[model samples]
Target: MDSLSYTPRGVLTPQRSLADLTWLRVGGPADWFFQPADEDDLAAFLKALPADVAVFPMGVGSNLIVRDGGIRAVVIRLGRGFNGIEVDGETVTAGAAALDAHVARKAAQAGRDLTFLRTIPGSIGGAVKMNAGCYGSYVADHLISVRIVTRAGEVQTLPAEALNLAYRSSQLPEGAVIVSATFRAAEGEPGALEARMVDQIAKRDASQPTKERSAGSTFRNPSGASSTGRADDTHELKAWAVIDKAGMRGATLGGAQMSEKHSNFLINAGGASAHDLEQLGEEVRKKVLQTQGISLEWEIMRIGEY
Candidate 1:
């Protein structure tokens, strides 16, 4: 038997396996998983949930690192009903659950310039949460406002200013759920925009290991404002270069191995444990710091437990 206060029109349960939800295809069971029918069902369910029961909203989990021990909270994931994309004039109003790449294509097809999102394989909510960016354009550059469901079950519209959007971060409440967002897209030729997307894909394929079973860039670019940042190189030294210098490009721990194609990416060759990946990452960081005197910052969001 199971116990949960809010049951959605779709389904509600505890101990739902999360491996199928993430791009990494990893992670343990969620304490409770709720997939409501629509906005109202989601709101009502949240309102009825107990105050002490922690809630965690997740998107497609593209940039997540859920540990093996599992998440001990009610996990709310939006689907079908919350996956619409609408365009009015030059603005795109999208459900947080909508895929970034899909929305990008829709915008491009409609002559709106959002080509930067064409290759990012995550949802709108994840893009907002991570302030996700590619090429030169960033999500923060086009966001207008977003709707959110608070931990206490109240829905409200929040301006970009209030969210305090910054590089790969926002002041999201501990368990506040992003519901939708409006982006002000620019006008551009559909053909040109799509051509640029193809070029972007080719560039990524040439540079990063896009096809391997790995999380994307393992570390954030050290902020330019870091107290003692590196000198401005035409192309700054990324995580890969640093790890390569440390002789960890193809390093391995258990089933986890630093990708040979792109040194920055770490892969689970097969049956790799969360601890293995985490440890491998730490080892790479330690080696890089010891050899180069530069600290690497993690970009992948490691959540849950060990």
Candidate 2:
């Protein structure tokens, strides 16, 4: 595990603290942290990396929880070189590191509608991986294809259908790192699109705890149960409603509290640890199941050792 072996044109560090890299500010550290100079650098480094080593591709760390014990893997974070956004007629191609909001705004400026991404946090990479959506539109709806560097350092292009995207999930190959994504956007008046994004931000701020140190929604809308406790695939029952029913809306553990403003938001009220945040989320899940008989599924990606 030395830089000489890879000969990378990137910044590499061992035992790097990850707390600052995450939104919640709670993770311990990464075994090794790497910020590649560009896509070529990333592919080259990955090619030289040992097969037994693990790779964790990180976005802006918006909806993640790295455990207190830290990840024993190489954490790769894309930066400036991979954040370009290009518009061509009806298509918008965005680099993996480009912020979702930025891409949305850029598309809107080009008189295209990608307004769905304006309120979503993190980067295009994470959005594609999670199939992120908002306001009735999803990445899957407009995605044409994606470029990725596989774990073995081979670059490949995969069509949108190849991903098998569904309900906030995708079938990306294991250890592959998304480099860019192309989306075919609908035509729209630039002014109209910008106004729509403005409205979305206002709505999100009014309902969600956007001002707090939160990892967005803690759980997905229960996909199997309705509010009446019957099985329903339509996912009509929202996670917050179930949490409110369980009486855990304003629940707290250490400095972690389910935001009073939005029950589904797991927030660091102040000085919270990763353990505290995760434990509180589990507690909420337990209560919801106990009271409503509906098991909740987490939306936030939690990784590393406890």
lDDT string, candidate 2, 16-80, tens digits: 99999999999989999999999899999988998888999999999999999999999999999
lDDT of 1 by residue, 102-204 (tens): 8998999999988888888789998888777777677778889999888877899998778777666778877789999999999999999899998988988
**Could you tally the backbone clashes for each prediction?**
0, 0
TM-score of 1: 0.93
* Whole-model lDDT, model 2: 0.92
- The best candidate in terms of lDDT: 2
Candidate with the greatest TM-score versus the true structure: 2
Error in Å for residue 232 of model 1: 11
